[model samples]
Target chain A: MNVPLLQVRNLTHSFLEGEEKVHALRGVSFNANQGEITSIIGPSGCGKSTLMYLLGLLDQPDSGEIIINNNSISKLNEIQKTQLRNEKIGFIFQFHFLIKELSARENVALPAIKKGEDSEDALERADQILNQLGLSEKLDRFANKLSGGEQQRVAIARALINSPSLILADEPTGNLDTANSEIVFDLLQRLSREQNLAVLLVTHNNQLARRCDRFISMNDGLIVD
Target chain B: MTMSLIGIIFGISFFIVTQAQTSGFQTYFIRTILGTNGAIRISDRFQDMKGTVNKISKDGQFKFQFKSREDAEYIDGVDYPGKIRNALSEFPSINGISEVFECNAALQTKSRNYSVQAHGIRINDHMIASEIENQLMHGSIENFLSDEMGIFIGNRVAERLNLHVNDRVNIVGKKGNFQLRVSGIFETGVSEIDKKRIYISLATARSIEGKRFGGSVFQLSMFNPDNARSVASQIQQTLGHRTVSWQEREKVWLDVFKALRISSAITVSTILLLSGLGMFNVFAIMVIEKTRDVAILRSIGFEPKDISAIFLWQGMIVLIAGIVGGVLFGVIGTYLVSQIPLEIRGIFTTDSFVVNWDISHYIWAILIATIFVSIASWIPARRASKVEPAKIIRETI
Candidate 1:
């Protein structure tokens, strides 16, 4: 196989709940290759979200290694991790967590701005991406003013603004209706193929998983398939 | 945020008004004292010895006289007043100089007798000697000067003796008892000065105290009274006389002014501190409310420092707004307070509430507000920065 865009080896994570240590992830391994939309589907409490977080670098694995674009990032400091996330990885959560105070374009441009890109240029890029996602009219609208579908589209525009090699999305269409979900899933797949990007999707929608380039199933904190 | 701004406004306004009132009283008190004592005074003991010897030689042997002190005590006077004036004239700070003969004597009326301080000032330089000319409540300094036996008594002293302008009083000195008339009764609002001081002519003072009394001192007014100490030191170095500044002469009053300033500072600081605490609570709540947003930003690639900076900028914006509003309201409040005609009579008398438009105080108030707001914001910003994206995301999911 071609060198994967993102690779995770023996990822483990645990949480302490009322003095009981519950294993959220147990030595889970996964690879997401360029030009492919890889979907991870499982039932609730199956550690799919936990693995996605570890791969996204939002949470540190207890014992594992995450290599992105051929560079090991597991040993990187928090600042380096944030920089890598800014420059190389993108995230789309289920809730479309856009800052309510900012406009849709500003929300999209935030990651690029944080990466020290010129604000005007970042905003211009954000406007172009948002337009491509059919959100041109909502560019100046505040996040809270937009509908659920429009907000998720803005989140997708934000995830694509930095043009990261790997996009880690956790239930990006979870809060959307069937029409919006199909539209978003189609857009992600198209972007993955056209831009040669690795798209990792964590979801409970098996029908959507079956349409991806590759699919992995998880249960009891382990990859079952 | 509104509460914080209001607190800052009230604190700064109170501070500005208090400073203005206290400074007004101090300025009035100092001016009154300077009117009588001058900005700087050179004692007679440091007078030129050679000039005294020449006077003794020209006038023959003079009788030794002790006024208020013991018989063995000797009181010297300024023998070369012109020489001292000429020497001080070279200094740019020296505005004007006057000669004065001061002594202790008993003022006896028909009903009551009191020991009083007598200042015999040059009629030509009386305005330069003290502000007594402007302080005359009953009669003019010209009337006091034209009458050879005329004396300017304080209002309290006049009240004590039931004396009025043109009233004759017995002034008994070591040389002889002289009958003097009160030509002017002045009120400086200083208890010590109003109760005990009386001004007479230099020639009359000399006659009453005998030939032993030359000009007892050289009183000087400076262009900037605040520079009196340095100028006095310079005069001492150049003229070989012991010089005293107005501040040094009124040490007790200056101490009182210092206490007033300290108390005002404490009050203003406490107010600002409470304002800061109020801001801290508001920012803390904002941080808590914006936790999910903070996590979202972190997930979008913001570093911890960047997260902190966003919240800090928010706090700084609020602080700037509060500072601008506070300053405007403070100035307005001070102006309003000044417009109210309130006479303050304490150790001194202030005709009206005076507001000093000193720019430094306003700048200090702004600086204090900025520091307090910064501290208030930093705590919440730090806490906000430490929020974990994973924890928030998991909780929400």
Candidate 2:
């Protein structure tokens, strides 16, 4: 009977791909709550990642309402939406999009700094997250110097630096080996249960999706189960 | 970026240095004219009040004032000398005023005779009257003041008449022959003054000419020569006499300077325009290289305006550097130009050319160039801000 941390209702999206109207998402609806991890699994073009992007405020929904922390942000401007994203939402991508020139600490600290946190405080916060993520010695190491698994962990540390309530991760472990993938997945799971954070995971790994607290089955731009 | 910066520097320096030379030339000529002819000259030229400047160009049409003591045709004099002196004293800008009389004379040496202009002045108040003493190539002011019949001759006159200090010469004026001694010789670097102009005591000028030809007029100097026009206009309004400022005496020369400045400005602005274009091109390329970083930043909560600010700040760095470098280079270039000893001399006697180093020009250049560079930078910054993070994220997937 508890209120959900993120609310979505009737999301529909389409795009013009070479003059053909491709419906990426259609009448999709979902909810995520605090302290829970959910997975979205489907074939290659079933709009799993598209739903995650819409939830993250990275793209506009064609006609839908997205509510984060009880605030309906569908009418917010770009600046307001960005502020809301920085304050309440975090994202993890498949490619570990860390800036190569920045060290692990700087990359993690960037989002906190963007939210107008004091830099010394932001870096200190980054250090705390990085250390807990087992990157204590990699604070000063540039993104390129870290291994693929290490870089993914650094990306996770960056996502958690601002202490957002909801994390939308699209295949956070898709590029890792079984051991590294398990390590990264275990961290995400621990964050959800321990911090009471809502997580939406878009993945191709059915086994990993089955292991989450709950999972959604998507097919042909709609949730089938 | 470096090329654009360099272009900005070159344009500003070239404009300032080139304009400095022409500005200096005008200043130098004005100084010479004011030194010898006084800052303002007042003559009872006509009885009209308003059309003085326009009426001056029309010669022989003016009705003479004071008609010569009922026949004072040759006398062009200030009506009340004491009232004029008191009125001039009320003006703090007026430094000093002297009465002057000039007459034509034919001077005969043993070998040749040369026609000359004799300027007569009071021996005591010689402030503005004898300002060119520094140009004395031979003889001295003290020597010129030693005798009652002493004369100051120009260097070219001395050269032609073979006259030196203590030499005797015969002057044929309206009254006939009179004797005088050459006490000094000066070269003013002005051919007209050095060739035929001579100076003598006021008493001697009257005795030699039998008081027939020369008429007294007021020659006033000012504390600041730049205020000469305003002060002269005010005086003319009160006294109703024709007053001529040094600027008015040399309008044709100043017009030549105006032409030179316009040409220099046109040449230099082309360079600055090219720099602005180069800046646009440079930042456009920079945005391309930083597009991925922009996408990442955009996706992670940074506002579009914040991304634009990053690129604009980079452009501002180049703009500031260019302005400082340009001004410094211009000063050095102008100094180098001022160093070359001018081989030929005419109105200005100095060995080197003159340069005006007022700071206002530098400030003006900075302001104008800042607008140019900022707009150039904004185009690219706007492009950077509009980067589509969703499109890039889709591509990566």
Candidate 3:
């Protein structure tokens, strides 16, 4: 736990269309410690999501360095990148994009199944996580059949099924009502502390941001606070 | 993915069954023809030998010398007492006989210069002429046998010479010859025979060839159609002479059908290509549609190639199902087609029945189907592998 879970230094990302280059994030720097819920807050289109993408190893920064669990990720090949993502990081999105065809339990077990995990063991673990999220009764329900709040919870259960060291959530409660949002935020908070896992959530919800262990604010593609 | 797999099965079933039926028909056609015609024909090495001979030619066409004065007699109306009796004594179970006397005859045209065949035949033999009689466009065998100097001419010759029945035609041979009457005009269906063959009696043929007292050219027919080849071989072995079956004489037809096989493969491959494209398109669309879900999958520890493998597995299932269905349908359809009544409308000589089934067709269909479907799945599978979990997750967020 002495080493930082995610360390980003002087990261920059840009998008090119025809001849014009638009910068999405510039010199964005942060360190996320283990066993803490860290929140990144900014106005719409202020690169908070970009920062999360970079931290999640989804996109390659034009110029920067990233260290996750003491391993340099920027120099890793595609296969290595995929392995790191699969083993060490979990992501939750604003929209609960669960596969409509699979049941809640099956959806959660999908990652382990893809990783060549034993099907029966994956299923048992998926059930345990779903039960922890109070979704044991809904284990066999399809994603689309679940209510929005239940679907969000299933997504969270799926994220934790892999037991990743770092959970990167981009606006995890952005789509929920205030009550559902509070419920989701409280779950995130409890899971982060109980599991001793580092959690990075990008959101505009000030109330949820205020509850996090640390607050990082962004504006105009730069970290301001 | 399962639904698409089912569709592939349905489509391939249609293709395989139709192909099998066509293959069955082709095999049957060849076998029936070969069964009736024998597998090979061994004849005298002389290439100029044509038709049956009722009379002995003084031109020394035969290698053996005559032993009696009866071998040189000119009987105006007589069956081949020598070869027919000899062949009967040799192979008793031989059921039918046909004689073709090679002679030159002049049609009673304006110029009297047209080339004429005078293929002499016995009118009463039903079994020997059944195949040929069925091909007759006009007239009957009785019409020619009841009259003297009667003849059966091909339809084309009848048209070209403007000749009809009972027309007096002068036939002159190198030796003892006579004038004959054209009793009936027959169509052989074959263009060459229709243009040139002239049917006459064995008696007139003997006088024209001046071999009346000797023997006619030997063509042995058997009771069991399947035994034609064995009988021909036995005749060859016993007589130490050569014989020829229609199959050996008409092998060019076999060559034409052999060429058709290439076209058949090309046709099946083209269909497989279209089916593969359809499969790839479906996979590509599915991946795009489930982008966000795929992102969720990646976040949960599924690698990019694992995502691709899922679609690949789905494609393989589709192809296998389709091929199995297609083969089943093809076999059933081939059976149905074999039950169809084949109609032969004109005078021709062939075995009408064909029983065709071969293992090669099934093997080829399976091999080609698998290869085609795999190639089809390759492109879309690659595209699926390129999906970045981070991009997907970021987009959804």
Best by TM-score: 2
Evaluate residue B136 in candidate 2 and report its C-alpha lDDT on the 0 to 100 scale. 72
Cα RMSDs, all models: 8.0, 5.6, 11.7
- CA deviation > 4 Å runs, candidate 2: A1-3, A15-23, A75-77, A144-147, A174-180, B48-87, B90-92, B123-126, B133-146, B159-167, B187-189, B206-214
Q: Considering just chain B, what TM-score does every model have?
A: 0.80, 0.85, 0.56
Q: For model 1, how does the per-residue alpha-carbon lDDT over B345-377 read when each residue is reduced to its tens digit?
A: 545666667667777777777788888889999
Report the lDDT tens digits of candidate 2 across residue range A48-143: 888877888888899988988788987798889998788788889998889999999999999999999999999999999999999999999999
Fnat values, candidates in order: 0.80, 0.60, 0.78
lDDT tens per residue, model 2, B125-160: 555543757767777777777887888888888988
User: Estimated TM-score per prediction?
Assistant: 0.81, 0.86, 0.66
lDDT of each residue in A1-225, candidate 3, tens digit only? 544788988999987646998798889888998889999999997888877777776778899899988888978986777777777887788887788999999988877776678999999999999999999899999999998899999889888887899998888798889999988999999998898889999888887898899899999899999
Report the C-alpha lDDT of model 1 over A107-220, residue by residue, as the tens digit.
Answer: 999999888899999999999999999988889999999999899889988988888999999999899999999999999999998888899998888899999989999999
Clashing pairs in 2: A35-A196, B67-B72, B68-B71, B68-B72, B68-B73, B69-B72
